[model samples]
Target: MRIIEDPRSYALVMVILASFLTPFVASSINVALPSLGSELGMGPFMLSWVPTVYLLAVAVLLIPMGRLADIYGRKKIFQFGIILFTVSSVFAGFSISPEMLLFFRVIQGIGGAMIFSNVSAIIFSVFPPVDRGYALGWSATGTYFGLFFGPTLGGFLTQYFGWRSIFYFNVPLGVLCAYATGRIGFEWREAEGEKFDLRGVFLMAISLVFVLVGFSSILSIYGFSLFVVGMFLLYFFYRYECGCDSPLFDFDLFKNRTFTWNGFTTFISYFAGYPVVFLLSLYLQYFHGLDPWMTGIILSIQAFLIALASPVAGKFSDNKSPRIIAAVGLFIIILAMVIFSFSGFLYWIILGLVFMGVGFAFFSIPNSKLVMGAVEKRFLGVASATLVTFRVLGQLIGMALIVLLVDVYLVGGSVAVGPFRALMTVSFILFILLLLVGLVLTLKAR
Candidate 1:
C-alpha cells in the first residue's frame, strides 16, 4: 500500500497517531487508579491530581505553544513535542513514588499540548478546503477511537500486568509515530518578523492553571476561595490579552458566530459529557465490584458506539447544517442522561452508555468541522489551539463539578448511586443548554 503517495496525507496520519496517544494515556490511567492508590498509598485527593495535573498543564500550555508554533514552525515544535512526550512516558513508567509520577505526567502534558495544538492546523494546511472536512472527520475519529480504547486497554494491561504498564504501553507506539513524523514533510511558513507575546502567554498560563487547580480542589478544601482566585486571575488574563501587541488568544475569532457558538457548545457538551465515562467506570468498579477486565468490556460498549457513529455524523455535517446535526446528537445525549438518572439496573446502564456514545459521535465530529470551518488557514494553529483549550477547560470544570456534586449529595463517605443519578440530571441540563447554543449559532451562521 502506497499510503505515502501524498506525503502530506502520510504526515497527517502520523500526527493523528501521535495525537491519539495522549488521550490514551489520559483515560487509560483511570481504571488503574484503584490499583495505583493501593500500591503508592495515595489518598483520594492525590489520586485525583494524577489526572488533574496533566489536564491542567495541557490546557494552560496549548495556546501559548500554538502561538509559538505559528511564530517558529509547526513541524519544529511538533517534533519537539514527540521527543518530550516519549521521554516523559519513560519517566512515568519508572516512577518510584506518586510525586515522581505526577512530575512526569506534567511533562507529558507539555508534549500533549504541542501535539494537539498543531494537529488540526496541520490537517487544514495539508488538505484542500473541499476535502478538509472529510480529512478532519477521519482525524477526529482517530482521537475518539483512542478515547474509546484507552480505558479498556489500560484496564486490561493494569489487571494482567501492573498499573505502570499503562505508561509503558505508549513506548513503542510513540517511537513509531515519532519516526513517521520525522520523514513526513510540511511547507513551513515562517512569521517573518512576528514577535512572541511573552507577557500574554504568562498571564494566560497562570490564569488557566489557577482556574483549573481551584476547580480540581473544589472537592477538597477552600473550594470557594479557589474559585474566587481563579475568577480574579482570569479577569486579569483577559485584560492582559486585550493589551498585548500580539495576543495569545485573538478575541476577534469569537466575532464569528460559528466559532463562538461551536466553541461554547463544545465546551458545555463535553463538560457534562466526559464525566459520565469517568464516573460510570468508577461506579462499575468501586460500587458494583466489577473486576478491571469486566469494567473494560462495559466501557468498550460506549466506545464502540462512538466509533461506529462518528464518521457517519462527520460525513453528514459536511453536506448539511452541523448545527442541526449537533442538536440531534445532544438530544440523544439528553435521552441517555435521562435514562441514566432513573436506572440502577446493569442492562439499562449499558443501553444508556450506547446512547451516550452515539450522541458523542454526533456532537464531536460535526462540532469540530464547524469550528475549523469558521477560521481561516492563517489562523488555524491558534484556532485549533483555542478550541482544544476550551475543551480542556470544560473537562476540568466538568470533572470538578462532578466531584463536588458527588461530595455534596453523597449520603455516606462512599458515594451512592443516587448522587450519580443526580449527576446525570445535571448533565442532561447542560446538554439542553448546549442544544440551545447550537441552534442560536446555526441560525446566526446562516
Candidate 2:
C-alpha cells in the first residue's frame, strides 16, 4: 500500500507545482512574444493584446472565484483549474489566428485565477501559524523557479522548436499538478454554507473589464468613455459589497492596517516592476540588437536571484517583522528602477536585474505572510485571492502602460532616450511614492 503524504506536505507540494505552471507559461511566452508576433503577423496594438487579455481575465475573475472556492471546496476548484489550464494550453498551442489565441489565453487566465487564488489559502489552511511563512516562501521559490526557467528554457524551446511549443509545454505540468492535488485527499471549505454573491461578481467583472480596456485604450475617445463607466461601476460595486452579508470581497479586511498596506504595497511594487521584463525583452531585442534566446537568458538573471532569495526571505519573515523586510525590498526595487532610467549599456542592466532580484525576494514572500497573518481564518480564501488580484492587476496595468507609452512616444519601435526616459521617470516616481508608503507601513507594523 502507498503511504499518503502529510496534509501540509501535500498542500505545499501541490501549491508549488501549480504556482510553477502559471509563470512558466507566462515567462516563456514573454520570451516567445517577439517570435509570436512575427509569425502571427500581429501589429503593435494587436500584439499587446496577447498578454494583456490573459491578465485582464485573471484580474476580473479572481475575487469571485476565490469566494467560490471558499464556499465550495478549494481542492475541487483547484483541480478544475488545472484541467482547464491544461486543455486551454492545447488549444492555445494550435491557435491559427490572433483572435483564436487570445480566446484560449482568456480561458487559461480564468484557470490561473482559480489556481492562484486558492493556493495560498490552501497552504495557510494546512500549515500551522509558525510554519506559514516558510511554507509560503517555498511556494514563492516555486514561482521564482518558474521565472528562473521560463525565459531560459522558454528561449531554448522558442529558438529550437517554435513559440507554439511553449504553450504545449504547460499541458503535462498542469496535469501532473492536478494529480498531485487530487492525491492530497482533503478539501477546505471555510465558508461552506455561505451564499455566493452573484450580483457582486457580475458588477466586478464588468467594471474591471471596462476599466482595463479603457486604460489600455486611453488615447481613443471611446476608451476614455469606457474607463469612466468602469470607474463608476467599480465605485458602485465597492459600496454594494460593503453592505452585503456574504459579499464576494470583504472590504472590511482593509480595516486592518497591515492588510491594507500589504495590498497597497503589493500592488505598487508589482505595478512598478512587472513591466520591466516585458520592456527589457523589447529593449534588448529591438534596441540592443539581441536575439530572443540571448534576450531571454539576460532576463532570466533576475529570476535566478529571486529563486535564491525567496525561501530565505520567507524564513526571515517568520522571525523578523515582514513589514520591515518588504520596505527594504521596495527600496531596493526603487534603486534598480533609477538605474534602469539611466542605463544605456548591458552591464548596468545586469546590475539593475540583480538588484531587482534581491529586492523582490525580500518583499514578496514577507508581504504575503503579513497579509495572510493579518486575516481571520475563515477569510483566508478571499485574502489569498485579493493579494494575487493586486499582483495580476498591477501586471495588467503595467503592460497597458507600456503599450500606451510606447505607441504614443516611441517612433517606429525605437527605444530612443526621450520615450524611454519618460517611461522610466514615471516608473521611478511611482516606486518612490510606494517606498514612502512602505516606510509608513513598516512603522505601523512595529
Candidate 3:
C-alpha cells in the first residue's frame, strides 16, 4: 500500500542510502591507504590490492547479481547485500593482516555489486519515462555526495580514530538501509519463472577476474596471458549466451542503435574520467605534500560540483537531446584533461577539477536516462547492470593505465608531473575520440 502510494519515494530512499555508503567507503579509503600500508606492514603493491580486490569482486558479480534480482526479487537481494556489506565492513575493521582486509574487501565488493546492479532498475521501475532522468539525476547526486564527502570524512576519521574507523563507519548506515528495505514493503520479481544461466555466470566471473587482473598487472607476461585467456572465455560466453533460453546478457539489446551507442559512449566516458580521483588522491598526498585531511578537503570539490550539477543536467535531459548535452560535457572534460596536462599551479589544477565535475555531471545522468530509455521494461535489470559494468570496466582500465604509466615513468613513487601529464594526455586523446564518435552517432540517429 505504501509503495503503491509512492513507489518512487521508497525506491529512491533505499537506493540513495545504500549508494551513498559505497562511494563514501570507496573515495574515503584512499586517504587511509598510507596508514593501512604502514600498520599492516604492506608494500605498495599489496596496498593496491585493498581497493583492487573490492573493485574486481564487484565488477565480476554485478551482472550475475542483477540477473538474480530480476529472477527472484530486487528487494530481497538488496537487503541481503546491505547486510553482507555491513558484516564485511565490521570484519574489515577488525582485520589483523593485509590479507584478511583484502578478503573482507572482496565480500564488500559482492555486496556492492548487488546494490549497484539493481538500484537503477528499481528507480526506473517506479518513475515514468519523462521523469526518470530527474530521479536518476537525484540518484547520481547521492553517489556524488558519497564521493564528495568520502575523502573529507574518511580523512578526519583516519586522522583521529585510525584507518580502521573508516571501515567501522559503514556499519550504522548499512544497518539503517537494511532496516529501511523492509519498510519499502514491495517486491519486483520480473523474471520469477525464468531459469538462471549458471554456466554463463561462471564464465563471466572467470573472464572478468582474468581481464581485471591482467589489465592491473599489464606490463607482465602473466598479465598478457591472463588477458588472452579472459578474452577467449568471454568469446565463448557470448557464443553460449546467444542460443540460451534465458541468456544472462541479451545480445538482441545490441541491435538497438541507441542502446549500443549509449553503452559505447558510457564506456569511453568512464575510461576517460575515472582516473582523476585516484590520481589526484596520490598527487595531493605524495606530490603536493599535503596531509590526508587537507588533501580530502581539496579533492572533495570535484564531487561537490558534480552533486550540484547532476540534477540540473537531468532536468534538461527530459526535454533536450542527451547526446548533444553529453557531447558538450565530453568537450569540457577534454579541455579539463588538456589543462591537467600542462598546468603547474594548484589553483589552475583545481579549476580543471571543477570542469571535470561539471562535465561528468552533465554526461552521467542524461546518459543514464538515455540508456535506460533504450531498453524495454523487462530488460531493465540487465541493462542497468550492463551500463554499470561498462563503468566498472572503465574504472579498472583507467587504473591499469595509471599503473602502466607510473611503472614506466615514475621510479619508486616519485611525484614527477611528467607521468601525470602523460596520463592526462592519453585521457585527452580518448575524450577527443569519444567526442568525434558521439557526433557521428548523433548525426546518424537524427
Candidate 4:
C-alpha cells in the first residue's frame, strides 16, 4: 500500500532532499547580502556575520549532534532539525532587525547541523559500502543541485520579491523535506546504551566559540588571548574524551591514517575553496555592473558541473583507484585558483569555474569514501559528523578571513578593484600552499 516500498530508497530520497534544502539556505544568502545590508542597516563588516553566525552555530553543534544520533535515534534528531530549520526560516523572513535575524540564523544553523550530521550515517546504515558510494554521490549531487540554484533563485527572489522572500521561500520545500524524513520509517541507534558526554559537549562548545570569535578578532590582543584559551580547552576536551568509555567523540577513529589524512584534506580543501565563491558575487555585481540575475548565473556554473560530475566520480571510485582521481582534482583546483588570482576577465573566470567545478566533484567523493570507510559501522555517525565538521570549520575560517581582510582594507560594502585584487592575491597564495599540502596528504592517506 505504501508508495515508497524500499527503506533504502526512502533513506536516499529523504537525505537528498534534506541535503538540497540545507545548502540552499547557506548558499542563497550570499547573493542576498547586499540586499540584506541595505534593508537591515548593516555595514560591510556586519554583513559578514549574516553567514558567519549560521556557520558558527553549525560548526559547534555538529560533533555533539552526531554523538547524540548514535546514542539516541538518528531519525528523531533529523526530523526535529528539519522542523526547526523550517520554522527558523519563517522567523528569519519576518525579522524586523539585524539582531532578530541573527538569532534566527543561529537556530537555523543548529537545525542544519542536526540534519546534516545524520545523512551519511543513515546511508551507511542502510547500504553496504559498495552501494554507498553511489547513494552518497547522488545525495551530494543533490546538494550541488541546491548550490547551483541557490544563488540563481535567491537573486531572482531578492530582485523581484525582495530579500525576505528568500527566507520565506523555504517554507514549502522545507515542509516537504521534513515529511519525507518521517516516511524514512527506520531508526539507527548504534550506541543506544552509551551515555552522552555533557561535560565534553560544554567544553567543545565553549572552545569552538572562543576559537571562532577570536579568529575573527585576531588583530586584537584580547582576541589572541581568547584564541590561546580556546586551543587549551580543545586540548583538555581531547584528553578527556580519550579517557571516557562513552565519549561524545570517537577519538579512536583517527588511529586510521586514511581517516586522519582524508579529514585533513577536507579541512584544507574547503578552507582554500569557498572564499572565492563568497566574494565573487560582490565583485561581479558592484565592480562589473552585472545585475543579480546575471551574477547568479555566473556563480551557478561551477555547482552545475559539480552536480554532473559527482555521481560519475562516485561510481568511478568504486571500480578503480581513487588516488589519481583525488590528486587530479586537487591539482585542477590549484590550477583554477591560479587563473582566478591573475585575471577578472569573464572568459578566464568561466574557465576557472569549469576546472574548479570538476576538481571539487572529483576530489570530494574519494575523500568522503575513505573517511567513511575507515571507521567501523558502529562509529559511522561520528565519522560522518567529523567529515562534515572539517568542512564546516574550513568554510567558517575561510569566511572569517574574508571579513577580516574586508574590514582591514575596504571601507564599505561596495567592491573596489584595488582592494579586491589585493584580497585575491593573498587568498591565492594561501590557497595554493594549502592545496599542495592537501595533495601530499591525500597521496599518503592509506
Candidate 5:
C-alpha cells in the first residue's frame, strides 16, 4: 500500500490544478469570440469588452482580495473562488446576449482574482526555499499546459459543438478541483488585529477600473478624456496609499531595487507576449480561414514550449543572476516578433510561436523568482498580488493598444492577416522596450 505523504504538498498540487482552470477559460474564449459575436449580434467594438471586462475586474480586485487572504486564510478564500468561478462559468454558458455574457465574465474575473492572488504566496509558504523553484516549476507546468490546451479545446468545442460548450467545459473540472481542495488538509493561522484598508481598497478599485475602461475605449469614442480621468484617479490612489497605516499596496516594496525593476520588467514582457495569443487566434480564424480545431492545434505549439522550458529556467535562476536569463529571453521574443512581422506563411508563424514560447518560459520563471526573493515572507501575498496586478494591467493595455492601432490601419470591419502584421510590429517594439528595461534592471540588481 502507498503511504500518505505531506498534506501541504497535496494542497499545492490541488492549487496548481485549480490554477489551470482559469487560463483554460481565458484562452479557449479567444477562439470562440468570432462565433460568439456572429451568433449574438455583437459589434466589433462591443466584442472587445468580453476579455476587457474580465481582465479589468481581475486587476481591480487583486490587491484587496490578496489582503483578505493574508488576514483571513488563503485556503478558505481560494476554495471559495473556485466555486464562484464554476458558478459563473455556468452562467456565462447560458447567457442569451452579449451584455449578459459580459456581466458573467466580470463575475468570473472576480473569482479568478481571489484564486490567483494567493497562489504564489501559498506555494512559497508550503515549500522550503531550496525547493521553491522546483515546486513553482510544477505549478507553472500546469498553468502553461492549460494555456496550451485552452485554444485547442475551445476550437474543438466550437467546431463540433457550439461556442457555449466552451464555457460548459469548466463545470466538471471545477467540481473535481473543488473536491480535491476540500480533501487536502492545510492549516490556516489567522492574523489578529489586522484592519482592512477600506479607503485604499476603494481608491485602488476606482483607479484600476478607470484605467482599464479608458484604455479599452482608446480605439472607439472619448478615448483621451477617459485616459485623463484614469490618470487623475491613479494620482489620488498614490496619495491614499502613502497615508494609510496598513496600505493595500505596501509602498515599502518599491524601495527594494530588485522588486521594483523586476516588477516593471515583468509587466513589459507580458505586455508584449500575452496579447499575441488572442490576436493570432483571431487572425487564423478570420483571415486565414482555418477551422477552430486547427487554430487550437496551431496555438498549442507555443504553450507546449513554455511548459517544457519554464522549469529549466527556474532552476537556472537559482544558481545565476536572472538578468542574463531574462534578457536573453526578451531578445528571443523580439526576434520572433520581427520574424512574424515579415512572414505570412504558416510555417514561419509556427517557427515564431516556438521561439516565443521558449522566450516566455525563460523570462517568466526566473523573473518570478527574482520578485519573490526580493520581499520578506510576511509580505509575500502583497508582493505576488502586486506583480499579478501589473501583469494584468500590461495585458489590458496591450490588447487595447493593439486593437486601437489595428482599427486605425485596417479600415475594414472584418479582421485580417495584414492588421496582425501591424499588431506584431507593435509587439516587436514593446519587446525591445522590455529588453532594455531587463538589461537596466539586471545591472541594478548586480
Candidate 6:
C-alpha cells in the first residue's frame, strides 16, 4: 500500500484509530463482563475490578505519559503504546485466572493512556484553528463508532466463541493501528529538553490510586481512611507542582478560563454518561432476560446516534459559540437521564438512549474543540493530557459509584425490580445535579 503522506490525513487516521481502540476495548469488555466473570469464577465485587483496574491504570498514568510524550516524542510513544496494547490483549485472552486478566488489563490501561494523551496534541500540531474542529469532530465520530460497535460486536464474539474472543477481536485492529503509526512521518515533541518531574509523577500516582481505590471501596472505614490520605497527598501534589520549575502538570494552565471551564463541564458529562452502557447491559441481561446479542443491539442505538451526531456538532461549533453548543448538549443529557429514571418500557429506554447519544456528541466534540482551541502551542500536551485525565477521572468516579450502588441495591448482583428502578432514579437525580452545575459553568466561562 502507498504511504499516505499528507499531514492532515496522517493526524486524522491516527486520532481515529487511537480513539477507536481505547473505547472499543473498554465497552467490548463491558459487554463480555458476565461471561468473562463466570469463566473466571469472579463474584460481583471481584468482577467489578476487571474494568476498574483498567481505568485506574489509565487515570494514574495519562498525564505522566503525556509529559513523557512532550519530552520524548508523540509518535514514538504512540507507536509503543499500540504495540503494548496489542500484545496485552493477546495475553488477556489467554489468561486462565481473574488475577491474570486484571494484570493484563492494567497493562492495557497503560497503553490506553499513551495512545490518548497524544491524540489531541497531534491533531492540533497538524490542523490549523479553522479546521481543528472538523478534525476533532471526525475523531469524535471514530470514538462514537467504537462505542457503537463495541457492545454489539463484543456480544457476537462472546456468544459464539466465548468471552475470550472479545479480547482476541482487537488483535488485527491493533496491528493496523501500529502499522499506521509507523507511516506517519512527522513527530511532535514541543516540550523537548524540559526536565521531567519524576517525584511529582510518583506523588500524583499515589494520591490518585489511594483516593480512587478508597472511593470504590465505598463507605467502608478502611476505604474512608484511604480517601483521607489520598486527599492529603493530592493537596501535597498541588503544592509541589506549584513550586517546581518543570512540573509534570502546570498549575498556571488553569488560568485559561476556556480551558478550565470546558474541562470541568466535560468531566461532568462523562461522569454521568459513561456508566449507561454498563448498567443497561446488566439491566437487560439479568432483569429483562435478553441475551447479550439483544442487549448489545439495544445499546447500539445510543452509540450509533453519537457517531451520526459528533461530526455535525463539531462543524456547528466552528460556526457558533462552543459554550452555547455544550450547554445545550448537557441540557439534553439531563432530559435523557430523566427518561431513564422512569423507564419501564423498551420505548422509554430507547428514547433515553437516543437523547444521550445526541447529547454526548454535541457536548464532547465542541467541549474538546473549545479546550484545545483555548491552549497555547507550548501547552498542547498538557492541555491534551488534562482534558483526557478529567474525562477518565469522571469515568472512574462513575464506575466507583456504580459499585457502591450495586452493593446496596443489587443483592449480590441479583435483580430486584424496585431497587433497580430506585438506582436509576437516584442516578438520574444525581446526573441532573451534576450536569446542571456543568451547564452553569459552561455559560459562565468566557
Q: Write the per-residue lDDT of candidate 1 for residues 163-242, one digit (tens) a residue.
A: 99998888888887788777765655445357788888777777776666677676556865776787898898888777
**Superposed Cα deviation of residue 168, candidate 6 (Å):** 3.3
Tell me how far the alpha carbon of residue 11 in candidate 3 is from the true structure, in angstroms, after superposition. 1.8
What is the lDDT ranking, best to worst? 4, 6, 2, 3, 5, 1
Candidate 3 regions exceeding 4 Å error are 1-5, 278-295, 407-423, 442-446
> What TM-score does candidate 4 reach?
0.90
| Candidate 6: Cα lDDT at 4 | 67
lDDT of candidate model 2 versus the reference: 0.84
Compared to the true structure, candidate 6 yields what TM-score? 0.91
Encode model 2's per-residue lDDT on 1-446: one tens digit a residue.
23355666667778888889888887678768889989888888888778778877888888888899999998899889999999999999999889999999999999998998898898888888778778888888899899788878888899999999999988888877887887787788888999999999999999999998899888899999999999999999999999999899888888898888778778878887888887777778777899866877788888889888888888887888777888788778878887887775889999999999999999898888888888887788889999998888887787787777678677787777567767666655665676667656755762
Candidate 4, residues 288-389: lDDT per residue as tens digits? 899866777888888999999988888877776776678888999999999988888888988999998999988998778888888876687788889999
| lDDT tens per residue, model 5, 27-61 | 78987889999999998888878887887788888
Superposition error at 420 for model 1 (Å): 5.5
Instruction: Please list the C-alpha lDDT of all candidates, in the order they appear.
Output: 0.78, 0.84, 0.82, 0.86, 0.79, 0.86
Estimate, for each residue in 170-208, the C-alpha lDDT of model 3 and write its tens digit: 898888778778777678877889999999999999998
In candidate 3 the C-alpha lDDT for residue 165 amounts to 98
Better structure of 2 and 4 per lDDT: 4
Q: Indicate whether candidate 4 or candidate 5 has the larger TM-score.
A: 4
Clashing pairs for predicted structure model 2, backbone only: none
Runs in model 4 with CA error above 4 Å?
1-3, 33-48, 96-98, 279-293, 342-344, 402-423
Q: Provide the clashing-pair count of each candidate structure.
A: 0, 0, 0, 0, 0, 0
Task: Determine the backbone clash count of candidate 3.
Answer: 0
TM-score of 1: 0.89
- Which parts of model 6 have CA positions greater than 4 angstroms off? 1-3, 33-46, 96-99, 278-292, 402-419
- Relative to the true structure, candidate 3 reaches a TM of 0.91
